[model samples]
Target: MNKVIKIENGTKQGVLNFLEHLITTDKISGVLTLRKINEKGICDYGFISDAKELKFADPFAPVMPINAAQTLSSLTPTTKPIAAIIKPCELRGFVERVKRVQGSMKNVLLISYTCGGVLPLNTFQGDGSEKIIADYYNAISKGETPGSIRPTCKACEYFVPMMADITIPLLGNSESESECSLIMNSEFAIQISKEFQCEIITSELDSKIIDKVLAVRISEKEKLYNKTKVTKDGLDELVNIFGKCVGCHGCSRVCPICYCVMCDFESHNFDYNIEIFETELEQKGALRLPPDTVFFQIGRLAHMSFSCVGCGQCEDVCPANIPVATIFKKVGEATAGLFDYIPGKDLEEAIPVMIFKEEEFEEIGK
Candidate 1:
């Protein structure tokens, strides 16, 4: 059964009040949410222990510098319980990592809100003030989509969280409304509700609003997919897509799924002798300075696309502007679809490549 908890004020102040209540009431040890790094508007995850620090908390910030999953994975199996405010994509990425044993959900409370997407870091010019965040939230609550949101976010299919302990619904709520609705999805959420003395009432999700948004997003995703589709299955096409790669490996570094401590690309095998480079130069008449650009990209696709959550961090950090996220999302969708698998949907489901059945993929074998 679903229960609704009314926030006395709007969501901005209501959330801050709730967080303070959680800390003062000894419900959580700390809070993990976004805070400004400096006077600039740049925001990153921070662990707050003092209620006074809630002034810096901007859980609804319209920017994602790095996926919070990586940060959450690093802090998991923690000594004490903590509350984490994360975006839907970040939560999904964390779910995938947890299944891989890279993260733990033992003592963490996952709280999420309706995401209105985010803008690129370069475009952000605010000072991470509460008013700025509140204004943006109010605008989004009024059904206005900002023009500065990222392309990937505009076409995102998973803007609303599904597996969170608590969810704050920003859609279908009028800006004039004094209270915000909280969706309790877990027993932990119910406990929190009781502790806060929030009224528990039966309520249904606004499925029509969600469906309308998803339909537009799906259409946009198809358009982007077609535009980026490879016409031929050949090395030449891949080269065109990845030819400008400088081999900085920034994409792998930011990827939550590329968890290998030592990647094959950085292994001793790629450390060739000068004579080998001379031989390649003689044979091909020309050689790219650092070879295996195609190999590295294809290797990553094979290794991580099965669990790719399409956070776009890979493309965000790419120096060459290779549209890495687009390619990865396209490939990831196709590869995962073949097995009827949705990464992060179920923790018990095994990774496709790690398990096999005689009946599976029989057509391919034949």
Candidate 2:
């Protein structure tokens, strides 16, 4: 059986209240989520042991390179009966990673929000700052899709959650009249629903509304892919777009899945021999001062393509205003499609990079 409930006006407030009840009544430990601004305007992650610290749940909280999955996996000794709030992308990564680790899913509660996509760091419609999202939240609690959101999001097909204990649909359907509606999936969610004892009502969703939103996303994606070709065209576009880039590399450094303790791209492998350098310098008028702009990006893509969550942090941290996330998502999608894989959708699905099958692509292999 399934239980669906809708909050009249205090969806966030209700969620916070539930978390508090879970901690006090249920005796759970902590809740993990993307950090948001608290009352003091301090930027940090939301961790609630007791009720006083629970901020209004903002699934789009920023400056977070590490998510519940990565953070949960890294704990020396994992904790149990904890609740984690994550976006669709982050939850998928956690599910996939936990399947492999197995130890990560012992007693965790998953709280997922229906994502409408997020804004890129360097390019957005607000006042040239990240706070525009928070400001938008304050102004319109409806969670307007960020103006400078990535094309991948506009086109992304993976909007639904398959593995969540409890799922919150942000893009409303028939219950547009209610605040936000909760759709319970797993038995864990049902248990939570029974424990909370909130109003039990069947969730009535508007399939047409959901379809319309997905159609718009798919349409935007096709147009984006149609607009971009292979890496060559992408490079010229990047050079043009990021002409002012200072090679800070903050994007990759802050990304959650760019997870090489030591990246080979930054290693001495690319340090050209003095003779080769002189020859190339004389042959061409001059090489770009940072020699491996293309190489750097390609290396990162190859490393994490199968696992790329499309968090938009690369473009966020770029000094040159480059659309790094867009390009990465395009490449990641192409490569993932080649493997017939979608990151974060299924925990049982094989990872393209870490695992392989012999007869996977006979047409391409031949």
Candidate 3:
């Protein structure tokens, strides 16, 4: 049974009020949201272990707290479950990683809010001091949607949080400048509704409007796919996309799904002997200092193409501003498409790249 609860203004303040009501009555362990401090401060995104810590879920706060999903597996499972507030993309990314890292989800509840989009760290024109999401929100509240989003986010058409236990809508017939509709998608969600004192309404959602929003998203995604599709047919075009890589390797370090107990990336595995180093540069008139740049990315693609959630954290941490996420997302899309799979779409289905079976590839079985 689907139950809908309406809120006023959909402000951070109101969201917290409803959440606090649940917490006080022992409905959930905690609820996740933003905590604003005067329009400038690092927004902390973590589990609110206690209801008193509701200050972090501030409405006017600017910060993207996507790390909470990564935190869930680290904490012990609780009888008192938690309600997480996340945007569409972050929720999908974490759900995908939890399975790989063997993270715990014993008592965590999912709550996803609508996404307006975001500005990356570099191009984001702000105070430029300690780069935060609050500044970006301030811009967005004024109806200035960031001209550019992380390439992965821009291409994503699943703007709604499909994996969430509870779904909130900010688009179409449920539209309200100050309201976002909330609904429970499961039996547990129904039990939680007992915590609320208001009547749950049955509202009509327009299927036609849903199609329009999705159609626009698909058109935008195809444009991005064409724009980023560069072939290895020549070096010039490839160089234009990945030329300035300084071998910092920031992307893999921040990715949640790139888990390896013994990464060859570290522990001097790639370190060359004195004779080997001299011979490589000696053979070529000029060898790029990071000689295996293209190879390294391809290696990661081989390891992670199916699991790649395209969180854009690689682009976030890049110092040389290399288009790393764009390249990975493009490659991942093709690799995943060949198998007709979308990474993180199904929690029960194991990643095709990670598992092999004797009966697999049925087309060639005969």
Candidate 4:
């Protein structure tokens, strides 16, 4: 049976109060959530053990400095239960990490939201940041997508998370009504609510409102893909797009799927030998300072195309402003479609590359 609970103390405060109650009453040992670090609106994930410290924690903050999934990879398989508040996309990324054995879901109570997307890091840290945040919540209150959000977020269809222990309905909710709704998904969520002594109401989200949001995102995704897609014959176009790369590897660093500690692209294998440089210079008359920029992008794409979650962290950090997320999203969608796979959707579903089927792609082999 589906269970819902409404906290009547406004959206952010109500959620915080619930979390505080859990901590004070010893429901969970700690919480892994986004906490504001300073007045500048800079924030990162904080693993908080004390209920009093949650004053700095803002689970609804519209800024994502890093996907919390990568952090979970480093901090999980815990000895005690930890409640993690993250966006739907971040939870999906965590599932991908867990499947790869980079993290464990042993004692995690995942709390996600009907996401309204997030601001790009630049905009979040820039001038009038407060106005941007205020405007963000305003859009949510009105059941409209915000104009100022990460490009990848505008196109994301998976804003409503699956596989969460609890889900907070922010997208289709009216915060002015002074009620915060929680969709208790897993048994753990129900148990926690009962332990906290909260009334469990049976209600569901308004599908009409959610569908309206989905329609806008789906339409935005099509337009984004068309704008950034690299065609089979568009090598020049590909170069024109990725050619601005500074070889910083920021995209890989922020990618949840690129879990390799030692990337071959940064290894001695790709080093510039004097002879190879001379040969390349002789042939092309001019060599780009950092050679194989395009090669690196394509190679990384091949490595993660099946698992890319379209978090937009890559483009967020890219100095060149390449639509790295969009390109990867387009390719990832195509590759994952081949196997009818959606990464991070199910814990039991094996990654297509990790499992072998004798009859799989039989027509191609024939």
Candidate 5:
């Protein structure tokens, strides 16, 4: 049974207050949420144990410094239970990581929301930051898609979380500005909510508005897929797109799914060997220094395409302005679709690559 709890203060404040309540009442040991670090309007995930410290917490901050799942993966399965308010994509990323043994949810209460998408880091750091945030919140209040969101966010259809223990429905509801509603999804969440000081609402969420946002996101995704479609025709288009890579590999660094401790791409194995260099020079007449730019991207795509959560962090950090997120999103969708899979949609569902059956894909051998 889903239980809804209504908070009297504004939505953002309500979340802060609730986190404080949870801490002060000993419901949880700490909270992991976005908190303002300085006056410059920068925010990042903060683990707060003191209820008074939640004053800096803003669970709805419109910027993502890093995919919080990576941080959660590093800190989780703690000695004590804690609550984390993460974006839908971040939660999904954590779920994917958990499946890979990169993280654990044993003592974590995952709270996610109907996401509004985040602004590109450049937009947030540039001038008019306040107006951008104000406009974003205004759009959010009306349950409409905010302008100037990241490309992946515009194309994201999975804005609503599937596996979170609790959900904050922010899409399409006008009352989101004046109050906050917590929808307890799991039995644990319901039991924990028994101590929360809020009114229980029995009404169902309005799906009409959510559907409108989803339709726009789907349309945007189709447009992006058309623009960034990698062809089986040749590597010429692939070379042209990734040719500008300076080999910084920022995309892989920020990718939550690329959980390797020492990436093969960065190892001595990829270093220039005199023999291979001479051979490549003889075969192709010339070589791109710091080789395998396209190979690295494709290699990662092959490795984690089925698990990419479309958080836009990779594209956000790309120095070359490569549409890394869009490409990954398109490829991930197609690859995951082949197995009738949705990454992070279910905890019990095994990843396609992690499981094999002899009866499956009979036509592949032929």
Candidate 6:
């Protein structure tokens, strides 16, 4: 059964207080959430063992320097259970990783909030003041799209946490009000409530408002996909789009689904001998130094596009300012759509490539 808990204190403080309560009650070994790293307004993940550290917790901060999914993957096969407050995209990415055996969900409790989109890391570094962050949250709560939000976030349709144990609903809530409803979506959440002293109320979610927001977001996502759609007409278009790739492999590095310990592109196979380089030069008149840019991109797309969550971390870290996220998201949508699948939608739904069905993809056989 779903349960709602109302917080009389401010929502931000309510979240912190709840985290503290969990720690004090020994419900979790630690809490993983964002904390201010310095006075420069920088914030990153903080794994807090003590309740007092909740003072620095800022789970609602509209900035994602790194996808916490990769961080969670790094902590897999963990020794102790912990609670993690994550964004919708991060939760989705983690779910995908769990299915691939890159992470474990056995001892983790997911606490997710309605995401209002986030600013680019560079933009946040420039002006991530308290007032700006507060104003952004206020705008989103009011169903307004502030211009500072990243394009990837603006186009994101999965802004609500569907797979979370506990979800904090912020939509349709008054901006002036300090409190919002906490929804318990899983038995674990109900169990936690029984142990904690918070009042649990039975209330239905405002599905109408959520649906309206989702419709708008889906429309935006379609527009984005159309704008970035790739074609198989020719390699000229592909080369033009990826012409500036300097082979830094930033996209692969930030991709949560790119879990290979040693990628083929990074292997010595890509390294050419002097004689081979001379042969290539003789055939093509001249070759680009550090060849096979398009090869590397297509290789990555084939390898990981099925699980791409479009978090924009790849584009965020790219030195060449390539629209890596847009390309990947567009391709991922088509690839996943081919199997009538949605990445990170469910834990039990086997990956399309991993499962074979006689009735599946009959069009291909035809």
- lDDT scores in order: 0.80, 0.64, 0.63, 0.87, 0.86, 0.81
The RMSD of every model to the true structure, in order and in angstroms, is 2.6, 4.1, 3.9, 1.6, 1.4, 2.1
lDDT, candidate 5, equals 0.86
Q: How many backbone clashes does candidate 5 have?
A: 1
| lDDT at 295, model 1 | 89
How close to the true structure is residue 77 of candidate 5, measured as C-alpha lDDT? Answer: 72
Between candidates 4 and 6, name the one with more favorable lDDT.
Answer: 4
Query: What TM-score number comes out for model 2?
Result: 0.80
Models ranked on TM-score: 5, 4, 6, 1, 3, 2
Indicate the residue-level lDDT of 160 in model 4: 86
lDDT of 5 by residue, 106-196 (tens): 8898999998899999898676688898898788777677878998998999999888888888776678768888888888788766788
lDDT of 3 at 117: 59
**How big is the positional error of residue 36 in model 2, measured in Å on the Cα after superposition?**
4.5
Task: Report the C-alpha lDDT of model 6 over 272-351, residue by residue, as the tens digit.
Answer: 88999999989999888668888998988898888888888888888888888888888888888888888787888888
Angstrom error of the Cα, residue 182, model 5: value is 0.4
Query: 3 or 5, which is superior by TM-score?
Result: 5
- Residue 94 in model 3: lDDT: 65
lDDT of 2 by residue, 1-366 (tens): 356865664556556667777877754787776545544333445566765666545444433444455665554134558887777776776766665563366677788766676554333323445466555344223433445455556666666665888877665433333465677777776675566756778764446656766777777877776665545566676666556656677767766565555667767777777897899989996887767676677777887776776766666667776777777788888898887888777777878767777766667845
In each prediction, how many residue pairs overlap at the backbone (N, C-alpha, C within less than 3 A)? 0, 4, 8, 0, 1, 0
Model 4 worst lDDT run, 10 consecutive residues: 225-234
Model 1 regions more than 4 Å off: 37-40, 125-139, 229-233
The prediction achieving the highest lDDT against the true structure is: 4
Residues 1-366, model 3: lDDT tens digits: 467777665545556666787789888777656554435454555556577777655532323443444555455356677777776666666667766755545566677655545456444434643444544454344433334556666565666666677776544423344664577766676677676665477563345655665676567667766776564455677665667788777778767666565667654877767777789878885666666777677778888877676667787778887767777877888888877777666677677766677766689846
Off by over 4 Å in 6: 128-132, 175-177, 229-233, 362-366
Top TM-score prediction, candidate number: 5
On lDDT, who's better, 2 or 4? 4
> Model 1, range 22-124, lDDT digits (tens) per residue?
8988888888898876666678879898999998887777888788989989889787778999988889888888888988987888998777777766556
* Candidate 4 lDDT, 1-366, residue by residue in tens: 469887777877888888998898888898989998888877888999999999999888898889999997788988877899999889999999999999998888899988999999988878779988999998987778899999999999999898899988888687644878788998888877686655668887788989999999999988887777575547898888878889899999999888889998999989999999999989989999788889998898787788888898998999999888988888899999988889899999998788988877767845
